[model samples]
Target: MSLLQSQVPGNLRLRSIDGTERLVGYSPPTRQNHGVAAVVGFEEQELLRDIKRALLRGVLIVGGGSLLALGMTLLVARRFIAAPTDALLQAARRWRAGDLAARAPGAARHSEFGQLAGAFNRMAVALQQREEELRHHAQLLEDRVADRTQALREANARLEAEILERRNTQTALLQAQKLQAVGQLAGGIAHDFNNVLQAVLGGVALIAKRAGDPAAVARLTGMVEEAAQRGQSITRRLLAFSRREELRADRLDVGALLVGLREVLAATLGAAIRVEVEAPPALPPVFADRGQLETVLVNLATNARDAMEKGGRLTLLAEPVTVAAGDPGGLATGDYIRVTVADTGAGMDAETLARAGEPFFTTKPVGRGTGLGLAMARSFAEGSGGRMTIASKPGCGTRITLWLPAMAVAAEPAAPVPAPRPGALPARCARVLLVDDEPVVREVLATQLADAGYKVTEAGDGAAALALLAGGLACDILVSDLAMEGIDGVTLIREARRARPALPAILVTGYAGDAAALAVGQRVEGSFTLLRKPVTGAQLADQVAALLGWRETV
Candidate 1:
């Protein structure tokens, strides 16, 4: 191997005896062909070196061709595929970031890639335009909804104002009718009251003249009492007719109420009118103010009497009825007591019947009627949760029917305990507190109490009465007028009761109807009894004795 290494110029070979191979190797100095020939046979080493050289040359040629092809392929891809694809990627990123104007720069290339970029830009533009259209439509719709809501609000406000105006007008007309009715009754009330006063004055004069004759004085006194009672009756009827107040509802048997009003109807209508009542015993009870019902009957009877100048028959018929929906009178579907007052007289025309319940609308001659009778009666019926309907025709009779709500459960008010006899009442030594606003009324009441043998204390107004009570003046009975300058009788009693919890009170008032008609009764606190004004001496004495639980000395 060492000999060959010194002698060889390229790949070396060595031959041994008998032509057997021994060594083969490579050397760096491959151009020394003579030394390789000396070490081995020339042809073999030379052939091997030639073969290696061919192999290296072939590898170099093939590698150079492959590198050139690869370079060409990369250049083509960068120009056609990579550049367009990169631009498309950049444009897509910008578009997603909401830049609608972003576009691939290679779009003008006039190839498939250019066409794709062009199509994508066109789609972006279409989407942007569609979004703008959607926004415009949404804005327009919102504006329309806002305008419609505003219009509805304005319409509702106008409707509410019109309703309020109609109600106010109705209230004013009713008030005007009430005033006119009161004015018409003024003349009649004065005439009747003057006659009663004359009788009373005559009786008193006779008693004064017959002072020494006990029987004559007693007889005259009786006449005076009768005259006073007649005056009270006239005033009561007047009050009932002219009362302008809310209804005080109570359970009442329609039959009993109609029967009780027969005498009043006869008196009001005179001898030319006959009143016939047909109320079945099985008629259901109703809820209404007793005084208001009486007033309604009287008004109808008066209207009937006026209609019949010569003579007429009035029939008051009552029965239970089940009203259905859409009834003729606009009554709600319910069980009701139907009270019909029919009169044989000059019937009303169609126009008159249509406007029957209108305030101050009357068919009678001017000044003969204020025209509030029918209107007020209808108003009362409605206020009591009922309705009044009129049926009439020309030359025929008129029937006014009142549909009143029947009481769900009929109840009887407990009767007031019987009062002690006047002679047996302890009129003497009972301390009394008398309160009134009017000087004359206060003086007269104080004198009457004093004369009744009671210890009387007087105050002119509710404030003075409260002050007296605050001063701790002990009182057995409190008699107070309702309307006063400061604190009213109701308030005074409430305050006074705080100090004397169980004090019995008698409230005297000209506003009896108003007090009774007030809806807020529970606010009054206690069961202080009410008495109407112009109370007689006997009535006053009896009330005071009863309140004190003291019987007069027999």
Candidate 2:
């Protein structure tokens, strides 16, 4: 297409057709058939005049407006669709490549373009926020891992420490058992040997002065006496170990004992440590073995002294108390003599406290503590039908209480002291039947009776003794063993009484006697006299003479 120039004023030509000269009015014609050729016709002048007005007026204006509108619509459509589509593609690529800073132009003319801009802006903002959140989350995860690793390390360390502690505990326990075995052997050996030494010492002391120069005799006597004295001390400690000493249960003012023991506690603990005896006056009387109670006090005092190397306070307090029912110590509600030995020493933690009552448990270095102290005290306290308790905390003080339950009966008057030596023996010497399981024991007593000119019969066991007595063997005394395999001493006494109603019976046993014969008249449930074993020949003579009324002329 080409534009052509025409003679018409103010007209430009758009050329079109091949090799043809054409004039253009640069406008549309009103008449449908009118063309550029009509402008040259003189006879058709009226038609041309009409055509000119149409081209110069309405058609020209309308056709120019239509083309202008079409151009503007295309421009706007491209801007709205194409520009935004390119921006979205770029933004998506940047986001996938991990750049949250990527942004697109958001300015627009129309609402469609405006809405797309708004959505893109919001997407950018959300992406920025999510990126920050992801970074923070990663940091948090790293911190958590670090913390968990540290905790695991601490847990492993603790478990290792616990295992080592258990191993040490086991070693200590085995050592304690070894020491206990040694203690038992030493106690048994000492108990038997001490008696033999005592007899020797007594006989030697009786006669040494008659045979030597005064100085020599005095020196010899002193040496022998010292040996015997040391021997006695050894016996005492051994008997303590055996827990078979003479226990005389007396109504004792334990509060007073605490008061008295306090001074000794001070001496033991030294002036650096404070000693307090909290025992108020009028603490209930505790039926306890006084010697054993003293032993317990000394042991506790010694333990407290050892506990506080840096010197802390020691307190011994005895208070009358009623234990609550179902209390932690398993004590019942009743009058109790609560003897507490407390120390402001570095106390044990819970683990040690749990095993405190186990025999021979000690925190002290070897030889510093026998570990028998607590065990012996616990045994003696329980022997009187009472309980012992311990309460302690790490870095805090330890308080051990001996809870002794006493009989609640009002004090009864002392019964007439039955003379241990039977009142003058029955008027005449009667056929006396002696029964004992131990051959050495029966021989010892029978020799005395026969030597004293009384006919005596002996039997080894309950069955033999009963047979002889039942077969019409005339006997005045039925002396039987308390502990035998087939029938015990109490049973023997009952059977003999049934067999011979008039016969006097004596239940004798080695278990009944203390080292001292002070226990001659022990009668449990009171049917026969309980004569302790190892009675002196003289004591046997005295008892037999009193029973028969005839002096034993041995």
Candidate 3:
């Protein structure tokens, strides 16, 4: 049993024929029921126990080492992952709160978490920069919009102002054109009419002188004088319209002017036109040229007569008026004399009314009417510190109002005025020299001087007069036509004065140019005077008598 036991590895169990547990040691059966139970060798039990203890101790040591390794791994994970994760969470929180600058800490920059943190910071910086740029762009757009809006508003205002100014300028231009046309027409009429008037007056004077019966002579003289006066009035109107008449501002009653104009219209406008004058007795007098005002009235009346081709009533009204500042006529604020001429005739339309005062803008067809009447009237009014207004409607006739500055006092009279009776010869017969380009004018004038009992010498031209004077023809007074084909009257007078330095000369002229020349001549160191053409015998005789210091023997 010992040798077998020695060969066996460790503790062993063996079962005999009897089914009983047994160790591999030699053991006797106890006397207890023939079933044997034996304690194995104590040493074997001890050895088995030792082997189990050693295996349990080694398992405990391995479990302790695994626990230590797990702890170390956890610590490393916390240091790298957990710490970065916490930082990232903080950055995310800050970013969500609109802090784009928030980023993971840079202390772990070498790790993946650090790399993620760096990327996040870069994105945040880019986003921040982009946001600022967008804000700046939005601000710029807002400012640009504001600037454009203001510029557009200013442009609109300027356009409106320019439009208004253009409209006013157009109106002024139209009115100016009308006045220019009228002045030309008037000047031409005056120039041509003067010649015809001269012939008529001379023929009438000759007829009156040759009358046989005393009653017949007086009647013929009266009729001829009336006609001559009417002709003179017409010429005055033409000159006034042309602005050729001198500015003779004087205080005059509008009523008297209207009365005289009524008679003129009666003769010229014919019986077809009915004229009415309605002026208050105590109307304020206007300071203006009397003849010009009369011309204004006559022109307006004639225009009215023309307007009413079918004959209509023309009313003239004069009244005192107050002109306030900002009045439509642009007159200074003060009291004014208002003269209105309302005509019952074909009225003007809106367009015509607006341009009524424009020169040469005649409503009538060519050759039928001249457009200058109203324009001249307005010009005269304006020249005299006043204005004109016209109110007209189609089919309703027209009303023209003239506002003239009121006069505070009547005009003072001259120191003294000499009165000479017409057709009176001088006390002393004076030798007179007459020169004219017209044969008929020279013939009638010489005849008139002869009737006045003055020896008269005749010359056809200025040269002839100069020749006569140079030839020692003595004369107290020299009368010459201002304009001639040869040497002009001014030159003849200048030449004649050398021979007769004390010569008293009278210049006869139908042209305004001649009048101007005569004015220049009068300024020279000699006695010189001017006479308008269509000279009546009486005017010629009176002028001659005055120059010679002749007086009528009472």
lDDT by residue for model 2 over 421-532, one digit each (tens)? 4345552365667777778778878887777667788888888888887798877676666778897666676677665555666666665233344232352223445565
Residue 150, candidate 1: C-alpha displacement in angstroms? 16
Evaluation by TM-score, superior candidate among 1 and 2: 1
Report residue 307 deviation for candidate 2 (angstroms): 9.1
Using lDDT as the measure, the top candidate is 1
Model 2 RMSD in Å is 26.3
For every candidate, C-alpha RMSD to the true structure in Å: 16.8, 26.3, 31.7
TM-score of each: 0.53, 0.39, 0.53
Q: Alpha-carbon error at 99 in model 1, in Å?
A: 14
**How does each model score on lDDT?**
0.78, 0.68, 0.76
Candidate 3: which stretches are off by over 4 Å? Answer: 1-211, 247-253, 256-272, 280-285, 289-310, 321-335, 345-383, 387-397, 411-414, 417-427, 517-523, 550-554
Better of 2 and 3 by lDDT: 3
- Worst 10 contiguous positions by lDDT, candidate 1: 34-43
Instruction: Give residue 93's error in model 3 in angstroms.
Output: 50
In what order do the candidates fall by lDDT, top score first? 1, 3, 2
Question: Once model 1 is optimally superposed onto the true structure by TM-score, how far is the C-alpha of residue 229 displaced, in angstroms?
Answer: 4.1
List residue ranges in candidate 2 displaced over 4 A.
Answer: 1-171, 174-286, 289-298, 301-363, 366-428, 450-454, 484-491, 494-498, 512-526, 537-554
Tens-digit lDDT track for model 3 on 113-137? Answer: 8788888888888988998899999
